[model samples]
Every structure is written in C-alpha cells, then in structure tokens.
Target: MGLEPDNMSGSSPEDIVNAVFGHFDPKNPLTFKDEQFNSDPILSEKALCLVYILGADTIQFTDDRLIEKLQTVRQRISEKEIPQVIVMTKVDEACSLVRNDLRKIYSSKKIKDKMQECSDLVGVPLSYIYPVKNYHEEIDTKNDIDVLVLRALTHIVKIANDKLLRSDFNKEQPLTYKDQHYSCDPELSDQSFCLVYVIDANIVQYTDDRLIDKLKILCQRKGKTDP
Candidate 1:
C-alpha cells in the first residue's frame, strides 16, 4: 500500500490522518471499505509490518507538522507492537559518495549517519532502518541500484515473514509465560521457542540469564529443549 507523496509532505494534518486511516470513495462502492486503513492484525488480513518511506533529501526539509504526523502514526503503531521499518530512499541525492557509486553506501559514514538520524526521528532501531538509492535519473537499471533496493526489500520481507509465522503460531495457541502455562500445543510451543531466538534480538529487551533459564525450562517441559 503506497501513499501519495503529498500525503507525507504538503497535506494538512487532518488530511494526512485521514489518508493514513484510509477513506472510502463513494463512487467506487465495491472498493469503499475501511480494511485498507485498519491496522488491527485480527481484523485485517496479514498485518505483518508497517514500512515508512522517507526521502533522503527531504528529512532536513521536513517541517514540524510532518514530524508530528509521523510521530502520531509511530505511537499508534507501537502500541500494537507492529514491526516498523524506515526505508530511507534517495541516498544518492543525500550523499555525494553514494551519488557517485551506490556500492559505497555501507562504507560511507555519511550514509550511516543519515540512516541513524532517520531511526532516531522515527523511534525505530538502526537495524530496522534501510538506506537505498532510488533510480530517479537512471536511463537503464543498474546492478548497484538493484542490489541496494533488493537488500532493503529482503530485510523487510524477512521481518514480515517472521511476524506472520509468529502470528500464525499465536493463533493456534497463545504462549502466555506469566502463569507458568506455556502453550500445551506442541507445534505452537516449538514455534514460539524458535521465535524467541529468531525474532530480532532487540525486540526481546529482557534477556537476563534467569529469564533465559525459565524459557529453557518451559521448552524442556514441552519436550523441545533446543532453542
């Protein structure tokens, strides 16, 4: 689901909010539904992740109003624990080194700092943010451009896939660790155990030895100790 460029840059807050929440066109009765806007995982079909695309060159040019809009969306999405990623597009325009050669993106400290800035602004971790150059002026598709774009997309897909797999396991059986009742469903338990290690390590903030021991015990009780 792509948003119009104006929705992020020039639109009023109210309009931006409406666009994020999604609006129904009266003329198109068949397409008029709130599902497009709804972020609820249970209500919506496969709400795996939310990707926020920000132009590399526009970050400094963005006004407070736009930042407020982004914050509002970030807060709402965070509440749901939905994985968020910032696609920092147009790195070529932002850094001269990258503009000369896309392969220099990772080695360029300037690009790294720009990515960090985006991460800090969006309140997402640096690992989740991806920097990529858009093929704006290229007459022919370049391998370097493709590689950068593909790398960003690959990360996004992997994160989304992990979320979907976890969600599916959750649906089969909820893994509630509070009351000593780990999921009785063996498949669910196994998947949850795998997820505990597979999901972004940053997501699991509490990783003390005691907590690890408890989880290991829980897995053992479920007959799968390997995590």
Candidate 2:
C-alpha cells in the first residue's frame, strides 16, 4: 500500500499503518484500491504475511513521521501475529564495497551493519532481515545481484509458507497418527497430541516433548523404530 505525501490532505502515519495491516477504512480519502481489503471479509482474512520493503540508504535518513508510521505498523503486525520480513533494497548504494562487488555482500561489514540497523528500526530480528541490491542502472542481469535477490525471495516464500502452515493448523481438524485422531485444542484432554512450533532462524522447531514421547510409544507398539 502506498501512503500520500506528508503534505497531502490525508497522510496520517496511523492511516498508513492501518492500510498495511488491512485495517484501513475504505471510505478514507487516502485509501487506495489495495488498501480497501478491509471492506471484504474474505480478502481481509487472506493476508497471511507482511513484507516491508525498505531502502538501505534512505532508512537512516527517514523522517520522524515516517518512523512513527513504521512503528505503528510493527505494532499491528505483532498484535496479529503475522510473520514479517524487511527487504533492505539498494544495498549497493548503501555500501561502497557492495557497489563495487555485489558478491561481497555477505562479507561486507558495512552491509551487515545496515541490515542490523534495519532490524533495529523495524523491530524485526536480524535473521529476518535481507539485504539486496536493486536493479537500478544495470542493463543486463548480474549473477551476484540475481543471487542476492533470489535469496531474499526464497526467505520471503519460506516465511509465507510457515504462516500458511500455522493458519492451516488453526483451521483444520487435528491430525491422525496410528489410527487415533487427536484434537488440537489446547484446553482439551487430547491437547497433548498437538504439536507446537517454535520458529527460529527460519526453522520450525517442535517443542512438545510429550507429543514426541507419545509418538515414540506408538512406534514401539507397532514394532518399529523411531525415525
């Protein structure tokens, strides 16, 4: 969603944040077509993840009003438990080494610091921050630039997938293992059958020891070893 300029009639930071979270009112003058999802229940419910694209060179120069809007957006994302990642574009412009050699992105301390700065400002973890060089002045595709962009895209897709998995788990019936169906409800007696996911470093970690033990027992009953 795009926000109006600061001097525009309806360009409040709160309105911009609301637009990002699918909470903006359709009748608002600043509202755009994409921001009108809040009017449709199905469209509003379909937003599974949020990607905040930020300019690497411009973040440090961002105005206080824009930063306030970003913080508001962060709050909404946290409140909804929506997975988010910051795409730090224009890395080449931010760091001289990256500009001279795109392959040096991972090894460049300057790029790393810029990524950390983005994470700090956006309230996202460093692991979720991706630094990429935008195709600004290039006529031909470069391998280094392609690699960086593809890597960032891959992470974005993975995060979206995880969010979808979590949403599916919430909406679907409990899974069945060993011919026994279990309820995913936390308050139910069969809650032990449910698996809880701890997302870290882009990996999904199952933290339910009881569920693991139960699976082991089930395997042993079938005369099979745990894989």
**For each candidate, what TM-score against the reference?**
0.66, 0.66
Report the Cα lDDT for candidate 2: 0.72
Worst 10 residues of 2 by lDDT: 190-199
lDDT of each: 0.69, 0.72
- For candidate 1, lDDT tens digit of each residue in 24-91? 33233222244554333242343467788988877876666557667777787666566889999989
Q: For all candidates, what are the clash counts?
A: 0, 0
Superposed Cα deviation of residue 205, candidate 2 (Å):
20
What value does the lDDT take at residue 9 in candidate 2?
A: 40
Q: What is the Cα-based TM-score of model 2? A: 0.66
Writing each residue's lDDT as its tens digit, candidate 2 over 3-112 gives 33364644566565555555565675445465444654443345566787888888787776666667777887787678888999999888898788888888999888
Cα deviation at 151, candidate 1, in Å, is 1.4
